[model samples]
Target chain A: MSMQDTASSGVALWRLVADGIERGIADGRFAAGDKLPGEMEIAETYRVNRHTVRRALAALAERGIVRAERGSGTYVEAQKLAYPLRSRTRFSEIVGAEGREPHGRMIEASEDVATRELARELGLKTGAPLVRIEAIRLADRTPICVSTTWLSAELFPGAGTVFAATRSMTKMLEHYGIRDYRRGATRITAGIVDATDAARLDLPLGRPILVVDATDLDLEGKPLVTKHSRFAAERVEFLVEP
Target chain B: MSMQDTASSGVALWRLVADGIERGIADGRFAAGDKLPGEMEIAETYRVNRHTVRRALAALAERGIVRAERGSGTYVEAQKLAYPLRSRTRFSEIVGAEGREPHGRMIEASEDVATRELARELGLKTGAPLVRIEAIRLADRTPICVSTTWLSAELFPGAGTVFAATRSMTKMLEHYGIRDYRRGATRITAGIVDATDAARLDLPLGRPILVVDATDLDLEGKPLVTKHSRFAAERVEFLVEP
Candidate 1:
């Protein structure tokens, strides 16, 4: 049914306007990063008052479908990064394939004893030495995710040093003479970014973040590393490949 | 590093308290859906004032990590539903596997002309006749998602009627003599729920929603149906399998 028909059928008028604009974006009438028309224009087109149009725009902004600038008009938000979850998933490769420059910075690297949860995930003793590397990954200079990776320090001595040099787990694994690995398992959940992640990812407080707890395995299917990565929900989405 | 170490490393006092509580939850000291300690108790434990404790709880509430009840204390939110993405994905099966009763209710159904995007997704000509069905799916009587599914009207005559009777797209296809289908492709993104969806899903306005745009194919690998499903991000997270 048409937006007007829905509005006439008891749906809120402002909501109908919001849905109409959303449909426009979906149909490519308003492309990503394209500025929306002014409030007066939208009001006239939707046959609603400026107040209703303002409410509609507010709703869109709250949804993150559109972003409003102080001096500029509202613009459709950038398209989300389409991250593919595959057997051989690689962050650099994924971001590169999307035609975005990928960069990583090590925030902290240390050797520590595994906690009970970390030990269970990595199949190690609770007191086993673990090399933990905390890092933030960026795509085109936009912070996309913050991750903390843990590995058995016994397996890869000096892992923190190697990772600090390479800033990539894959490259550091190669430095350790392990050539190939695959995704073992991933558990996904949605949560608000904690204070630490919010600052690291440059995300607004309380914004949704996609939490992925994953393990990687060596060619022999032995667990190599367990990591928790939190992606800014507005900037990236995981595409699960069958 | 320890919580105290981070707390002393220049983070805000209130944030440190929040992180400590979050760590407690992660370590199973505070289980999901459990009421947190009283504000006074937490304040004393964290060596902070009651105002700081209240701020920390407010931050947690905004993050969807914990919920505050009127006249009662704040409680940890329930664990998310892990919905796996695989070739032969089935919603009912997923929810049932999670030990929850799956239910679907038809909200709207009609014959409609395909828009360009819909036509491309369904492998039909532009303006082709299609049957559209909008539904709300619940797990354990709690609304989890709202979906809109479309199929070729010529290929599946009476699809709307069959789906209404069965409350299942799989069953409706089965009624048309197609027993098996597989997920062809799925694109997932995160967004704030629009007004209609907020109302239908019984979610608060501006809550995060995980949008899954997917196409299903028959055994012969021909596209049979296309759908857009919006899951409540707080309630469910999609696990994409390789």
Candidate 2:
């Protein structure tokens, strides 16, 4: 508290240091999972008291930027695979962009009646039988994403066999003659993981996950794929293109 | 552990109950965040022991399907989101599909030499200056996404003025007599939030954030926009056309 520089309006010296660290984060000078220098080192570098540096680092810990190990120094949290926010990239492709091979396991492929949400996406009557495919996408043998796709059964029969052969739902649709697909709109939200998904994805339930609800369309604007994907917050990402 | 029907093994009863609930989760019968029945009630309903019910619930938790809170029972985890794996679309349009008005806070807009990454994207020299615009994008009023775009300054002279107008960056380019852009490949990654970015976006540092890195080109195959975006996990998504 004795150390004083310029802006001494009682804003707290530690806070100023914390602000600088925050800027570093926003500007990408420091990346995720990176470790900061030791408290004594930071104090010397910033010309501040060691306690003040501790206070700044403490602030960071509260904000979840740094993880404090009692005897050891703090560490940045591990990051997940991100989705491109500004591009037209597929989930499988984004995973590869992150340098991880993308592999999807088809958990269940069956016909079921459309529920309220599926009906809206498919533009089908409620309770209409539809083909539902539940698949889990993995990276390095770790399950990171879970998806459920509902398709109009009337549009494609025996899609299961085709999908089983090549593992490309898109190609299977083409084999059944519904080839053209233009991108469509999506609905997005954040939700916590629940019991069953936690088991399948091997995640702790109550963990927050990204929810992307999307509908694909044909050249004629016909609905093609209506899928709901649950991604582990710490494991996956969505990118935006500009 | 001792409770079971004579004909069926104890483990079988648990599996059956687990399957029933798993089916509900897969079928969307028990939506994310929906509370599940109590062990007693589930046992009565599924015709199994309470121990069987507990085992089933435990299994679900392991799969990230449900979370049980003491005195509050179990609830479904949030639904998963699916981001695309391919390269396509623009950033503004991607968020637009999420049904939100997207806007940005212009941070830096200047014509400077492209760095190594930008040079590779624009097929220019390492020191070749590009029109770089940095902004923090907001969804509605909440501060969420951050993006930086680099456009070849050689192609556009007064590109700095693009930030002055509220017009979209790409549109601003079009107004300057440049039109049409074809997207190229993009890189996506998921990592922990750096202390700096976590502060700017008002996110807790060390939390998982999504990132998308990509370059764009025009009809003549001249590079247009090289964008890198960092997104908070809860506020972003990507769509797959296929």
Best by TM-score: 1
lDDT per residue for candidate 2 within A189-241, as digits (tens), equals 45545556877887533334666677778877878778887777556545544
Residue B50 local lDDT, model 1:
90
> What is the lDDT for A67 in model 1?
87
Clashes of 1: 0
Per-prediction TM-score, please? 0.79, 0.51
Best by lDDT: 1
Q: Model 1: per-residue lDDT, tens digit, A60-114? A: 7875789888778989974668898888988999999999999989999998899
**What would the per-residue lDDT of candidate 2 be over residues B1-242, giving only the tens digit for each residue?**
22332321112446556756865765577887888888899988877779879987886686566899999889988442334444455556655766766676777687688777578877888998688787887766656667778877877776767665754776776886766676676655454455457667866433345666777777777677778877775455444444
Taken in order, the candidates have interface RMSDs of 9.3, 14.4
